[model samples]
Target: MTRARALDLARILFVLLTLGCAWLGFRGRGDEIADALADTSALGLAAALLVTLLGLALTAILWRRILARLGSPVPERAASAIFFVGQLGKYVPGSVWSFAAQAQLGRRHDVPARRSVTASGLFLLVHTATGAVVGTAAVVTGVLDAGGPRWLWALGLVAGAVVLALPVVRRDVGPAMVLMAGVWLAYGVGVLALLGPARAGLDDLPAIIAAFALSHVAGVLLVIAPAGLGAREGVLIALLEPVVGLDAAIATALLARVVHAAADFAIAGLAALRARRTGVRPSPGLRPADRRTDL
Candidate 1:
């Protein structure tokens, strides 16, 4: 098989692995899911979905800010759609479909494939780092009780930073870092607000950060899981149970997945409709001349 084919296979395996993990997580634990679902009120689920959508929108804004700093700015509508649409590509395995779609759209905007990939990578690294910092803070200050296994936060940050600082990433690292810091500050405030009465005292900050970090991390890893079915719940049970209790955390993760999938469907559906109306042929990758065209 070719290099691309090998990479694709790996992603498929990741999806399978995620499914296996999720199965193991819930195996013989039917009562756990039953209890979690029973406690999950419709209002609570709705609220969780709203929060997830809002968080993703904020992420889109962050992406726009980074792209502006990169000199290949894409409008918010296009960027947001691209972000949502990209979510569907995880079904292709190896996550290549996401990159492939990005490259295709970027090319339309006249962006080089390398630059497009770098841009996407930078956004991910920054987002992950920001979440890690916040999650670690939550754990540290007693806002969350998972402080014992807090090494994961530090390790994730270091690994993210290393990838971001690599030579290829370095070309855009300067601007990306600056934008990321600003965004991180905003994100910190937002989550603190979410924690509301739960966030008090500086000691609680690290643990709060850790919770947010773990939540985001869990969401991301869901891409490799089958339709994100059990992966989110598993992560909540593993990392968030100590902080928020298994039932609440599991509900939160499941609700988040529902919202994410809804957004993806909404965005992709609109894109498809628009394409059909406009009679524009859809290319498989990013073209260089599409930067100014509206999606």
Candidate 2:
């Protein structure tokens, strides 16, 4: 009945929810995931998994940065655990679970609920708004690849970055925007890795990255599908099919889902293990107010 005991129980419940959803998600779609992985070479899968993991880590770091801006900086290891574990909630039925889980998970590390929730919201906004710019730049890159000047792609990308940065030029969100831009690029490469060299060359990577960015932006905007399952893949297939052919596009989309989910699971499981072994706590000098707020 004590507040501390209540919080500990709630934390356990949230982690269980995330892990359970992850289990059901894999159980429900294992066949499709296996087929997708089977289509790619072992090397391709390895590369995709590596990049996806990197992207996931960057995403966690992005959230950590946002929390720091909100005056609740957490330790890197604990932040990683909180973030990747919280991310498991995306497998559940709604987008809000991930945010909610992160808010509760932060309690163990001394982050206030308001700070964690605010960071989650800002993280989503940064991810999406920057994603739109990244997606648009990909279109520019695609146009140049198709017929226009090849060098213009760089110009287009700069334009897109500037557009996103100008409005938030002095705001704390600016760096987070920059980091999300890089995260999208990393994930785009993860998608590109699923393709064969013959199917998509470096020259074509920009176009592929564009399509990937656009698809994810669509996924974020469409809140109905958990983790952007149907909508993301659908948009990806539609946009990518033209460039990579229908068969290759569909395979890439499936492979992307499998690879991305693997990244989430792998990182979360690893972070969980790390937290268990080390027994993490709040950063030194955590505010008394933060300690009291979330409880």
Task: Determine which window of 10 residues in candidate 1 has minimal summed lDDT.
Answer: 191-200
lDDT of 2 by residue, 1-295 (tens): 9998987687677767766765664576667777777777888789889988888888888887767766787888889888888877777786788888888888877777878888787677667767767766656645323334645645645655664564433365556666676787788788888986857877777777777877887888778666887788888888788788988988888778777877887899898788878878777534656532210
| Model 2 bad stretches (over 4 Å) | 1-16, 19-32, 140-174, 284-295
Q: Write the residue-wise lDDT of candidate 1 on 226-294 in tens digits.
A: 443455446544665564555455554544444455554555556545543654432333345533221
> What's the count of clashing pairs in each model shown?
36, 0
Provide TM-scores for the models.
0.60, 0.82
lDDT, candidates in the order shown? 0.53, 0.75
RMSD for each model, in Å, please? Answer: 8.1, 5.2
Error of 1 at 139 (Å): 2.3
